[model samples]
Target: MPVFNQYYYEPLETKDVLRLVALDPATDERDPLSCTIFQCRRSAQRQEYSAISNTWDEQTPSQTLEIRCDDDISYVRITANVDALLRDFRAREKPCYLWVDAICLDQTNGEEKSQQIPLMGRIYGEAKDVRIWLGPDDRVTAKVFTLLRLLSQVLDVQPQWHMAERVVFHLNEVFCRKDGVVGLKSLLNFFSRSWFSRRWVVQEAMLAREAIVHCGRYSIALLSISLAATRFLSLDVASYPVNMAASLREPTTKRGILELLWYFHEAECRDPKDRIAALLGLVPNEKRFPLDYTAHWTELYRQVASLAFGLNDRAINFQLLRVSAPCPIQEMPSIRRGSLTGQSLGNGPYLSFLTYETQTPTSGILPHLNGGNIRFSPLTEASHGSIGIPQSAGNGVTESPT
Candidate 1:
């Protein structure tokens, strides 16, 4: 062998950037994140490791656990039993969701972690409650637990937990943050977070989208990787053709769809491809680093029928939005920036219209009148030396307000 390449390679998004794969530090060490409550068990399944990691012994062997939190924890004392820990937690009378990486995933190594990385947004997105143990030094757990409790609760239809739990999107802490369709409780208004923390700032703005939390000020790099790695093109789910009837039922308004659109937009605009990369982050000059998310967006749309929005959302008329026909990233990168207008290319409302549920974060929804094709190699490149928008008006899109 040759030595590792150190040249700076600019990725379209974040996950491409290599992040420190920090493991739980040794027990003897002053690990700031130690002492969180966790439950573990041997995994029935196994994952493979390689020389890259073996040479450095950088990771622990893969293992899975049934990490769970008990509803009753207030009764336990020091040196408590499992049931006791449960009692202790409950005695505080706090409502929280357990954020166990081992319970939620296999901590055997990187690839397994990588596959689950995309779901980070959703996991963080859906969880009504989040927390961090903060070990000895007072490390931050992203305050996921506290955020959940603060979000206003909406007493919408009681979710069929048995059914919803099947697809609870345990990954995002958000019920379907896994994309089966996670949602925030209605009436949640997080305007006060800014007073206490800087972390909650972006979380709040992204949370604002509700449909697609995590964008703009968030880690662009991580967003890129998750989109690139998503298996949307090969989505396998039940068929759900657009319901013309539902579209007319209430006229597709932004009420039920804003969150979904926000989710789509965040995923689409990510330049790199993964969450770890998001940790590394990227600069957010839209012109210098246009998001390369055609692949994931295409799949997001392709899986509409399999997602939460079925007959209820597919039917709304899209005539006013002038939404383009449905297409996949295999077709072309979506670049609306006209060559002459250059950096100032601003797309308007109809541009927001999407043929499929996830392709674009359009405020409106519409049916495709044109051919069924995939939009390949979209506006992936940041530098626009010569290319311009499609001359034909048939396939282009516009942003909501514009």
Candidate 2:
């Protein structure tokens, strides 16, 4: 293993520079779990390991836990959430190699963190499995599982639950009754879990080759929950139905990095910039903006907008901004801030334009010519009917409109 030094560790010869935790196979479950760090090259050599994705709670650091090693007892502090996850992992019958960011990374060393943070995508992507810890199981979790299972059966008939009228009929008949209200409430609470609202977990979940979700003693495949959530939300029931369209609701399926950043803006992070950094690897065009830990937050935001506009400059039009409220940041340009505001990036009014039943059509409007697509040629003071002038050309001095 390479020793940590200065602002950067010496670059390894290979792409694999990960730290794995080796658990003790000894007795005394009550004692703090013993762990040792090991490093290896992942791309050159294949190794089986599971990566744990979780939030570091505030209370856990202050509360010290005791660990007994070789007849010596010492107290160490860890986040409550991580302490629980480690305890649960240690209780398993077979010992396994795991990579947990909170323990594996030297949090105190800013230099080490700067080097390791960018590799987060590779770390989770290389893992054989990514275990998502959503705290513990409770009544809400139990009910959520039950509801999702029922939704799966309904969705089996049609992947698009909204199109399956028969399933909609069945759901109303079978689960929307007086007693089922309790289950509906549970579904709402289930989606409200802090795990779904996290920015870091978005990348962690997206990059995993395979993943599982653990809640207390109960465990389920990540795919199962995602599929079930998608199906349940797809059922567009009129009454007593889950509002899948809620801005903060987590999508039941995978989303790109930009979408996740926009959708989960409410997610909590110790550093505001992590809101952008955490999703770097998961973006579809991640290569466009390489991860740079030293970049300013404003610069990062500009980089994202610049790349997006580069792909389609038509995105710079003001029609996209018309529908959205003014951006909260007065310092940021409206064009850049409105990039994620659910606006069309093409040279036309939004597709929703036609859907507005109450909107009145203005007279003299060209069939397809709206303010969005009408390009005006530059006109000099001497030009009479270049482009800014009306179709009635009152002068013979037209220079081929060049």
Candidate 3:
């Protein structure tokens, strides 16, 4: 028996230089996946390549792939998800250049991983195309893609149609058909895929110059899927990970890093620190937290809270604190409990104050506070508190503050 040579990554020379895998085309389905790693400067013009946006399927055991580096043929273990993607690409007639994180980056080297992770936005953004892999096609994949295409066509035809009108059209034209029911269920299943909920895809999709979603042999423009999602999914029900990519591209709905964090909090990542790191690219450099995977999760959380508080935008700050749940790490400061008036304290200790009111009966609607002079002073110890501002009753009259 002959032992296969093990592949090893050459260290990236500079921050601007990264690896790209050139996949060797296979004529037979049984052929092993083969690729060559080569260095490329990200800043170089006229470099055509596609980057993959995918969820790592860690649940499955790893599989080996043939990698030709320099003069020797070597084998490297890759996740099952990546193996599937490579196989799909390998079946093509011509060789293709691709930036797949799992294979292109040196996963074992922490330093290399840290450096490459931050550059991912630029990597995807600069690429001629971004391919989103939602794993291989399943039973409902064909129906979902067909439904997306049909919906996208409807949207393209009536681009200016109002939301209500679009909903009506969907109900009458799309949903009214016999197969439409099955298609709708398939669409639901499609959106429910793990790919949609992955944290990294948010930035990947948002930054791509052009993106195509690939499932097995099926492919479609990401814009088509986004448009279909907007037209079909209700605003309240749609998860930010699945729905916010298109909105983020729009100038009017552009959000800062803090807002992005709040919206994409539920998006999954293997590392908790990545919850902050993944969205850093979308925000301006000044607003970005330092990209340090080595930092403790609590430290990252604190930095986020600190940055949010530093902004001193009452509305944004209020929203930030209101939505923040108690951190699982107890040592971390509770910014929610710290500031009542939502003012910057300049690294001073934060204090919390709770307001209570007597119960008044009329309609079920709670009374809104009109005007009151509330005093605030810094306290020696930190604590958590809540301020309840009830909804305004009819007649536009607000209850006097007690």
TM-scores for the candidates = 0.27, 0.64, 0.72
Each model's lDDT: 0.25, 0.53, 0.63
Top TM-score prediction, candidate number: 3
Is candidate 2 or 3 superior in lDDT?
A: 3
Estimate the TM-score for candidate 1.
0.27
TM-score, candidate 2, is 0.64
- Alpha carbon deviation, residue 92, candidate 2 (Å): 4.8
Query: Where does candidate 3 stray beyond 4 Å?
Result: 1-4, 91-93, 155-180, 234-254, 310-316, 319-402
Judge candidate 1 at residue 357 and give its lDDT.
22
- Relative to the unseen true structure, what is the C-alpha lDDT of residue 57 in candidate 2, on a scale of 0 to 100? 53
lDDT of 1: 0.25
lDDT of 2: 0.53
lDDT of 1 by residue, 88-149 (tens): 22212223223333323333444545544443433434433322211111122122222223
Instruction: Kindly give the stretch of ten consecutive residues in candidate 1 with the minimal lDDT sum.
Output: 48-57
